[model samples]
Target chain A: MDFTPQELLIASITRMLRGLNHVAVGASSPIPGAAALAARRLSDGHLRVSVLGSRKNNFFTDGGRELFDCAAQGRIDAFFLGGGQIDGQANINLVGTGGYPRTDVRWPGSFGSAYLYFLVPRVILFREEHTPRVFVPKVDFISAPGVSEPNVYRPGGPYALLTGKALFAFDKARQRFRLETVHPGFSVADVEASTGFEFDRTAHVDVTPAPEPELLALLRGPVRDEVAETYPQFAATVMCGSDDKENRV
Target chain B: MAEHGPIVSLDALAAQVPDGALLAVPPDYSGVAMEATRALIRRGVKRLHLVAVPTSGLQAELLIGAGCVETIEAAAITLGEAGPAPRFSAAVKSGAVHIRDATCPAIHAAFQAAEKGIPFMPLRGIIGTDMLRYRTDWRTIQNPLAEGDDPIVLLPAIQPDIALFHVPLADREGNVWIGRRRELVTMAHAAKRTLVTAETIQEQSLLEDERLAAGVIPALYVSAIAEAERGAWPIGLEGRYEPDAAHIADYVRTARSEDGFRAYLAQHVLAGRRAA
Candidate 1:
């Protein structure tokens, strides 16, 4: 069965999330939501995932009171985050560009990357595209840490690195990142070609599998509907990918 | 030059901050605050305090990592960090600094207590939980005419020594226009000194929008103002940039491991301080 790039991306995220007991998804992130839904439906509800966004689930939400109360109470086991730029060590930067006074680009990233990255034991870094622009040799700034370099420990660092082209698992032993697997359509060469810097590829990389039919159904159904009502921009983006019609196989 | 407090450079502002001073920080504005913390830490100030709503992002991590004076969880879940760091968790539980989870009403009660120059305010909720145990400074009083009933706890007023906010714009006299977000207002009214760091220093009259004008942090409350560009890099302002993954990764690698944490401080923060 052939799957589009977006489908494959969602499937890979689901696979990663399924391995965890619980997960946290950010706001307006279709990949995170779709993946969580896919994991629950495909894994037979074995996965317990929680969604956290700027807006509280209910109106009576306290301002900074229950913040991370879920995680503190051990409700979440894993988390998914996105970034504008990711570096070799897996640090993420959604902030400003190089040259401080005037940045080259700016983005509206979720505010809690530092807290989430620091607090969550396993944080999966997901991005829509894999390019030199997004996957840079070094980020202009450091929003969260991927790997602690000499003297950098403030708190909340990234755990895993996920990209559109390939999947990465950080190796603390070597102090450099290693290739875990590549997306189904992408080859080692394809990933290497996309990235500007040379990555360690000593081991053979596996190809991520497609989402199960049941998983895709969950994503296209309740999850999609819920997210659409919550975030219209994300709904519009996901809807553009494929027809909402259910697939009959 | 003006009737209000002086405008200082980033270095001067960093130097002026005293050691062990309680700093009230916005829950989500970590990117901007970290740079300031780094500057202050470089100048050898310890025992910082943070006031924030728990959201998963850069600001929350810095507060935990830097070891704040008291971290009041203003939100539902501490959403900032993806997972928990054992050291930070231990710190919260052990009460080196206080970590309280409460509602907006409780927060407002505490701030109102500070504004009114009171020691603490009695609240009905948060009666029988771990929140009571850790907040020992908060007193408990008997309910009038109620027998065999547990007493309600009183949350102490949070009058911070300084309220430091990083926003989009400010005037030379430290008249801050927070744009649409009013998260800093409570700190402004509750703190003894208010310091602001802005992305740009525009004229005072640039605040023309009626809605924005209503949220201004007046010069009377603000003691110092400085211009810090890309101030919220790792932390984010709604319309501004995102976090720096590389830097964050470096911080994680260095801080998560004990040896890595020491090495990181030695090289980046400590060494940089020596150089400066």
Candidate 2:
């Protein structure tokens, strides 16, 4: 029962998106794209997945504005966002590090993460790098805050943060992250050592569930092929589909 | 009238843009005007207010590296999956360029305000965050009409001096078919001038055909047009092709240092100065 890191992350994310009607995966997200496909497949296509920047997966015939419009109308139930640095407060920084305007390390500016984070009900904060540098005490700049003021009209915010080591669910009431599960082969201490932000944890932590053989087959087979249309290089290398390079769109 | 049918060379189009212009460009992975960016570098255009319509990638990084940009106002400027934008990152780190960071909706709302000739637009979110703190232009005010404790953020309009992009077609009438990339239309509507590069000059007017008419950015808004096939090179265009992955990867690798970036400009931009 050996699964790649990508498969594990995919499984974790799919479980987070249990009954969401429509899940939207943004550009540069191959892992989430695969997970969305898996969720849709398992739900008998009852779940709708819109993979932005994908020619085949996207059904927006109107244009680029449709994605935002759909989210605003509450049609999009789930979305994914990542950051260069994520903190305990659920503040994520896609912008540069160090300070505002001037920074020692610069990342991309926030795209639709801020807007969609407010609109999408289940905003999953995901990042593959699970170290202190990424999981910071405080993010340098907040691209999208995990919780908004009481008056702000927001239907969505951070639900859970999935990383290489563990999964932490955001408690909006407490404005903190609680350790949900540590991935297989990783310990609570390992997560504690790597995570810069403090989080409440159960005395007995559960290992992340492994994907069943059926799910595994779907991931390696149809799901990988679907993701390759948008992220050819990622699908090629990450999903162990190096042989399927020619099949990429 | 002079601009209505001006299908000039890429050089001519780039030359129209002078120093210290607030230029609005599209995001990465959609209608990125890369050829024009390269030309702007070759022209040594200086002190540009580079507005990344919502977000950006190679185009912003290339300009920042060339030292042609003085300010960048955008959401982010990474090379997407290719990783960090080396030049943009280095410039910000060194305090070489002014960075005005805002969220995606703020940028879009600004454009929307400009499109409608409004002073500002109200948007949700940014409260209880650093985004509102760093942005002096953003203001939070009590909702005069609301019942209780309701405050909202308002963003001033972003009216750029120029809007530039590449597309699949622009007919003789200057009507450019943008397909589903509606942000370009908003950018064109918001900017004072718009420059477009195209893969093909259509034989029939885009407006004449109902199927294509829905996607056309009316020639009324297009001030200049250039026939630059693969104009969005290294960047992808919807329905046309995938981003030049090898080229994007090369840009990430070569743009890591000042010298490497200069070498890239020499090979791709300055050396190919045969545009005008």
Candidate 3:
């Protein structure tokens, strides 16, 4: 069965979350929430998922609350975060387009990214676009850093980068991002052509699988339905699909 | 000074509250706020309207265990338990508390409208949602002066009789300073009378810091102040001690059954009663 890129991305995230003990998802975060829910139900509730911003106190009888507060209590082992601009070193800048205070374009800034990035151990960065604007050589602002340069590690750093065409992981030994895997329909050349800077790419690169039938069903059914009902803008985006297919910018 | 009003203890503040009186609490379930809630329940208050972001499993358990509050209404419910717990499910079914998903803006607007001596405010985005139903005071009033548009629903301001908050520091005069979370600002601005519970009573100079001073709840608005250590017991402060897991677990267990909740309340809150 042929799957769309978004489906593949959701499937990959669901797979990664399945391996973790717990997951912390943020408010208005459709991808992470869907992935976590999928992991929990598919994995027989083994995946402990917690969602933030869905409740007042961290403890409620709602599904979103159960998932988020659990993650906050260190119950979550992994967390998924979305980035607007990410650098080669896995530094994420959700604050603005460029430097802090002054920037080319300004985003909403990091809402819960600062706290969530600091606390969560393994933060998987996901973005629908994979272009120079997003997957930049260096981010404009240091909203969250994957790894500190030469100084002591500060708060709000991303750990991994998951893009539309490729996947990147932080190489602790070299203190840089390395090409971990590429998508099924894309090649090394395709990835390099889209990215702004050069990356260390070994001969071997794994392929990200397409979404299984079950995953596709889940995404289109409960996931899409819930998001559409709750958040209208996000739902519009989901229905419209990414702006660019070949180079998701 | 009226015998200091019997020196309200940390555990007995709730009992001091009058029945049918509106009570406003902080958004998050910090330990101090939780302790205050436990106290309020012991006072035998009948109706509770929590000004919170949403409810969590632990909080639901706590409310259920209190057994005093007959009806509860809040913005949302956060499920804290892993998977579905029978006890937690039962609480929702019992209709003791009704959960609604309304944002802080709606809550703030409601309070602001009340404070300004207005009836209601016309809020956008929540038109077709369940919030309209939950907030029955909301009404669809026609724009009589308009040419040809449909009527708009106006949300009535929710002016609670009392607003109680816990913070990191406070002055003797009841001025409060919350470090990171500014949720208390909404409650303080919206409520009729604001009460504060703090970890420490700091010198007035602590408010000199430009950043910290901005978040201070002024003495003019605050009615009462108390200093208590580990006051936010079961729920921890941001940079402070962790939540009491044992207490949370006990709350979960005790709140599971009505009989268990009554017994738990008797032992923890009522039994050790001191003069109030």
Q: Tens-digit lDDT track for model 3 on B147-234?
A: 7654555767777777776677876545687654555665666777776667777656446778777767677677676666666666
DockQ of each: 0.03, 0.64, 0.03
Question: What DockQ does candidate 3 have relative to the true complex?
Answer: 0.03
Best by lDDT: 2
**Which lDDT tens digits does candidate 2 get at residues B84-140?**
889888899888999888777788888999999999988766776677788889999
What is candidate 3's TM-score against the reference? 0.51
True contacts kept of 1: 0.01
RMSD of each: 15.7, 3.2, 18.6
Q: Residue by residue across A11-38, what tens digits does model 2's lDDT show?
A: 8998877787899998888888899999
C-alpha local distance difference test of each model: 0.59, 0.85, 0.58
Please compute the TM-score of chain B alone for each predicted structure, in the order given.
Answer: 0.77, 0.96, 0.77
Compose the digit string of candidate 3's lDDT tens values, residues A1-249: 655666677777887776677676665466666677667768876666655543321233322223433434666577776767777777666544543233345343343343345446678888878888887887766655566433222323355677889878767567677888899878988888888766777888988766788876766666665545333345556634434254332
Docking class of 2: medium
Q: How does model 1 fare in lDDT? A: 0.59
Cα lDDT tens digits for candidate 1, A1-249: 544566667777776665677776765466776677567666676776555433323221333323354554555677777767777877666544664213344333224554455456677788878888887888765555565433322234455677878878766556556787887667999888787555677667888666676656666666666556434456566544346335221
